[model samples]
Target: MLEARDTVEHEIWWEIKGGTSNVWYENWTKLGALNYVVPTDYPINEELVDVSDLIEGGAWNDQLLHQSFPADIAEHIKSEIYIDQLQGNWDRPWWMLTSTGRYTVNSAWNMLRHRDHEDSDFKQLCIKGVPFKIYFLLWRVLKGRIPTDDVLMKMKIPIASKCYCCSIPQQETIQHLFLTGQFATDVWQVFKNAVGIHMNLTQMKQVRYPCLKNAPFLWNELIDFLEGYKPILVSKIVYWNLPYDGWYKCNSDGASRGNPGPSSYGFCVRNCHGDLVYTECKELGINTSMVAKAMALKKGLMYCFENDLQPLIMETDSLIMKNVVEGIWECPWSIVAEVDIIKKLKARCNVLILHVYREGNSLAYFLTNLAFYFAGTSRFNSFVDLPSAGKRIINMDKQQIPNIRIRNAKNTSGMDIFT
Candidate 1:
């Protein structure tokens, strides 16, 4: 039995080139047998020959092979010449057991234990934004591996297993503790009300807890996924400031009273030193804020083009506008014409299109608000002789004052339409 096992292992193994393998006895072929052998009647100079004896003039010697084996076997062996076979040094053993040709106990155990089981819920629990600890705890709970009171009691740990949150003497379990209990129901209701989601609790609970295997995994995975998804659009704070030297920073904003109500686009341009170069507030007839934003960008680009403002950096607080201009997103058909105009103007000079926090773009936001008090378009070419409010906000930007950012809060509104 041992010899049979050795033969099987030997048939599947080969030595690397630098080994002390006897070319006559060692199984060097991937087939684990000699491809050609010395003919029985042939006479040889020595009892053993190494592979180097077969090489002459940097190539396999046809004369030596023909002298050792018949033409048929010699031709077959010559045709099977492999690059690695010819170039390798005998460094280590090569086995066909693992991918790396080197095996470990862990790899063998995993190979033996691999079975196709439904583990989709466990996989989905590893959602990108969820905390790792939360993912691990929920995974354990779904696997019935958590040390809950009932589980601890079953393991001979002294503990009461009854539900304590309500007056009922029900045994405490994952389902009863988190889904069916009165306290749990009230907590879920608060979450439901806050998120504006409604579902029949009895039906959900009925559908949730029956399985000793599948149901809990699906339900827990879904709950954790929603909890993980709730924070994707949470507000972030980013400071805005002046452009690099030899560049003009233009910040534009678009505002509307209603979805299709009175709107305007406003932009304020400043040099690298935060000195205001110009401000424009032009009235836009009934249009969506999206259209106002598109027009505002086009107007800002055109202003730079006409004024020969080379190496400009145009910024906007609208994420939508930034995406549209950078070609990361497509604009609506209504705004495509304006976007094209902006693109043509952008191509004429070195322009950097950027997105800034509304706090950083407060001067442009203020200019848009100024449009609210005006019945017609307003254009100011110089900071001097400007209104006190305008001067104050500009001064704030110049001083690099830190503005307290509020999430999802709008501080100003208006639009600009430039021909």
Candidate 2:
């Protein structure tokens, strides 16, 4: 088992959070043990024992870090190895081998069995109903481990490399033999026409594995797929409706760069005239998009209450959140406490939470995305203070310009329409 020390180190990673992880003892830095990376002269602050000591109010304390460590190390901690600083949980060991961060026999076996590892491209090859042979073939293709002409030539075999698939006598490289050759081009052309995808596929490095899995290998299956998904415009019911007089509407949205990763939320209070009253966008450290959404709504409610902006209608794009609030769906156990807080806030005011489509809630979405551009939470009280694009969206909404949501023609629900 000692032979697997390198493998074990490669597989397990410390997910940094507010609590549990010791600053010096744990492998949270990914550079190996934290003690080794520390400067010899720099004194480790006694107060900085836990990871939480490094964090402050959902962000890394930039000032404290620069004072505590060498400038480069402090920068790395606040930038590269940084979490959002409010993970709401203790630091834990995450299995790098699995998506769920949990260890499993199959994952362990795969790590041990595979001599050559590819850049996660082989993951798409393990499709449901796909054969193991296809999976193996694609895995080799991605890893460049297959005995192609170029690969075989590298093995010191005295042989000339030539492409038999194409009329041009190009060198039989992996890209030429499998992708750019005439026969391969013909095969792809057939699917390109069938799928109606208006994109170039020649970029070798930019291949998305999901597209490869979805593209039909069998011609007969391709025919059925095209037949099922013909081109047609489907009407989707989505638009911002004016709130009743003496009432204000709050629109909130939350999103993440990756689910349960770097996240943020935005919310706004708007009057019946479609004018923005107050808006705020903020980062939420590391959390799921669901948590971010819940936090957005919660913060929006809190803001309204604090400002005495009452009789509010809350609009969110998250359907699950709407259902959870209305008791129509099970609240995610992670966010049950948050949901309860929202419930109490709802009781405090005339709040009606409703689900809105992305098109209808474009302004909130735009606001939510603003967190990515700025360092911290940003606030807007006047329309002029908003970004130009945001102001345009507001103007469009006030002028009753419709936002369309695309749906399947087979399942059209007539509401908003444009030819």
TM-score of each: 0.43, 0.50
**Candidate 1: tens digits of C-alpha lDDT, residues 330-397:** 65544554676677677778898987778888777877778878887799989885688889888877
Q: Give the Å shift of residue 227 in candidate 1.
A: 23
Q: What lDDT score goes with residue 275 in model 2? A: 94
Q: Which regions of candidate 2 deviate over 4 angstroms?
A: 1-230, 410-419
Model 2 shows how many backbone clashes?
1
Candidate 2 lDDT, 222-324, residue by residue in tens: 5566457544566565678888898999999999888979999999889989999999999877888988998898889889987888788999999989998
TM-score of 2: 0.50
Clash-forming residue pairs, model 2: 84-285
Estimate candidate 2's RMSD in Å: 10.4
